[model samples]
Structures are given as structure tokens and as C-alpha cells.
Target: MTDVPFTRTETPVLEPITMINAFTVPVEESERFLRRWKSNAEIMAGKPGFVRARLHQSLINGAELRYVNVAHWESGAQLEEAQKDPEWYANTLQMLNDPELHIQARPSIYEVVVEVEPGARLLP
Candidate 1:
């Protein structure tokens, strides 16, 4: 994925929609989980209004959340539409049906309320 520049203009405030999913995967199935998650993320990236997707793994040993997915979208409606697609149900959601994986996922959506960049000063 190409890096997109995020500029904060003082006159206009922009709030990007974000989705975060925390996954707890069995140590034995961590690799498989990563692969499946990446595939799912790729599919979502192809949809309209997809801004960016990122998967983060905890470096701390024995962390409850082994993997976390943080995705940014243009709006909540766009995200809801993408989730309703049949392709998402067939490919991404189906992965959860596998009992062998023993994966637990908790997902949530949020609106970005504040942002700060280095060397950027707030206008008075």
C-alpha cells in the first residue's frame, strides 16, 4: 500500500472513520491467523472508501490480544456497505467458522476526533 499524506488544515476539520478489531489467537495457530487476516484486509482495501488497513502484533509475551487490525475508512456508511458485500461474507467472515483456529475477535468503530502532527502548531 502506498503511503498517503495526511495534512491538517486549520480552517477545516476532518474526522476519518476508523475500525479496530482485536484478535486473540492461539499460539499454535498464529501464523495461519495472520495469513487469513491479511487476505481479508486485502479484500477490504479493494472496496470503495477504504483509506488504509494495518495489522499490529503485540511484542509483549503472553499478551491477551495477539493481533490487532486498525483500518481507516472515509465514513461509517462506506464501512457498513463494504461489510454487507457477499464477498466479505464468503471470504472474510467464513474464516471465523473454522473451529480449529480457536480465534476470538472483538471489533469496534470510532470517529477520529483529534489529530496532531510534528511541528504543527494550533492556530490561535
Candidate 2:
């Protein structure tokens, strides 16, 4: 009889939710939007249930969707609470209302149905 010399780590299974926001901005105003976006991101990062966030930029110049933000939260409630932070709200309002930026945003929360990683086998 032989025993494996390894220990398995146990982690809680999470039904996490994702917050995705797609933004349309003029090419010229991208910098301004990014600056304000960074500030807003910082506020979310400090909130509870925030797992992580990534902002993606489109390769095409002057694309309709200039930037897309994808963030993960432990629960929808936590994400909603974080978004209510006064500083974040003010920053978001200012950024969106800035005529120079002319940004349009489509934001929503989603639940992941399935995920496939590279080199992973499909289940039967």
C-alpha cells in the first residue's frame, strides 16, 4: 500500500456574477474617458466582493465600442452597493455628462453559463 504525498486545497464554490460595460467614445476623447474610468475603477476595487476588473480596447480605430470593461463580483448585491458609493457615482456622472467626451455606455450584470479554458477537454 502506498499513499500519495500531496494535499488538495479546498475552496468554496462561488456563483459569481460579472458586470460588463461597453462604452462608445470618440477616438479623440479616449484619453479623457480613460482618466475618469481609472478613478472609477479605483473606487470599485476598494469595495467588498470585487474580484477583479479588466478594460479592453478595440483594435479598430474609432470603433463604436471604444472600450469594454469586465468586472467580477461575488454577488449582485455587493456590486450594486459598490456602485452606490458617492465618489464613484459623482465620477461616473461627470464622465458621462461631459460633452467633450460624448461617451455612451451600455452596462449590465450577467451570470456565466459555461466557460472553456484552453487545452481543456469537453465533457460528454
Candidate 3:
């Protein structure tokens, strides 16, 4: 009898939840903060428990763009824990130098109740 060197095995790890939040910026501030915004996104992507994210810029002629940051985590606890790091504060400060950028933001937490199966539909 011999044992295989490699075999399929399952190990349990903390599975996190998906969090979606939107950041609304004034129309006048977009140009001033574009670089800072990209940098912040890159920083968050490098954090632990990060899954994926997308930043959406609004298309409305005169409306400010809303940057939606979505991330999947192992748990709400993990998300909350990682956010307490003081490094987050340093990175966040870089985002505030732009005078045009409104310091105020509207963010919300959501728990997904149901999800529909994915479909392949292209927008026109």
C-alpha cells in the first residue's frame, strides 16, 4: 500500500460577507481627487480579506460621481477588526487634502437576504 503525495483536501477558513458602500463626491471635486481616489482603492485592495471591488463614476450630466466600494470578507468581525488599524488613518488622510472634496459622505451597511442566479446579459 502506498500513499499519494498530493491529494485533494478541504480545510475550513473564515468566510466573510459582502459589503457595498457608496462614496458621493461633488461634481467640482472629481478632477481634483481622481488620483487620490485611485490610490485609496489600491490600498484597500492590498488589505487582508479583500475579494474584489469596482469604482463607478456617475454619468449624469451634472451629478457628482458616486464611487461604490464593494468588498467580500470572511466575516463582519474580520472587516471590523482590520479597519481598526492605524494605517487606515494615514491612507485616509491623503484623501482629504483636496479642498473641493466634501469631507461628508453617505455610507450604509447591508445584509444580503437573497441573490438571484447570474445571467449573461449585455447592456445596449
TM-score of each: 0.78, 0.82, 0.66
Between prediction 1 and prediction 2, the one with superior lDDT is 2
> What C-alpha lDDT does candidate 2 achieve relative to the native structure?
0.78
Clashing pairs in 3: 15-74, 16-73, 16-74, 16-75
Predicted candidate 3 versus true structure: per-residue lDDT over 63-101, tens digit per residue: 543566666766566566655556664555656644456
Pick by lDDT: which candidate is best? 2
Tens-place lDDT digits, model 1, residues 1-124: 1122211112111345788888888788888888778777888989988899989989975888999889988877777777776776566555676656777777788766767899878786
Looking at candidate 2, what is the lDDT of residue 60? 98
Please give the distance, in angstroms, between residue 49's alpha carbon in candidate 3 and its true position after superposition.
0.9
CA deviation > 4 Å runs, candidate 2: 1-14, 120-124
Alpha carbon lDDT at 114, candidate 1:
68
At residue 37, candidate 3 shows an lDDT of: 63
| Decoy 1 TM-score against native | 0.78
- Point to the candidate with the largest TM-score: 2
Q: Give the distance in Å from residue 51's predicted Cα in candidate 2 to where it truly belongs.
A: 1.0
What lDDT does each candidate get?
0.73, 0.78, 0.57
Worst 10 residues of 3 by lDDT: 1-10
Measured over all alpha carbons after superposition, the RMSD of each candidate to the real structure, in angstroms, is 9.6, 14.8, 14.7
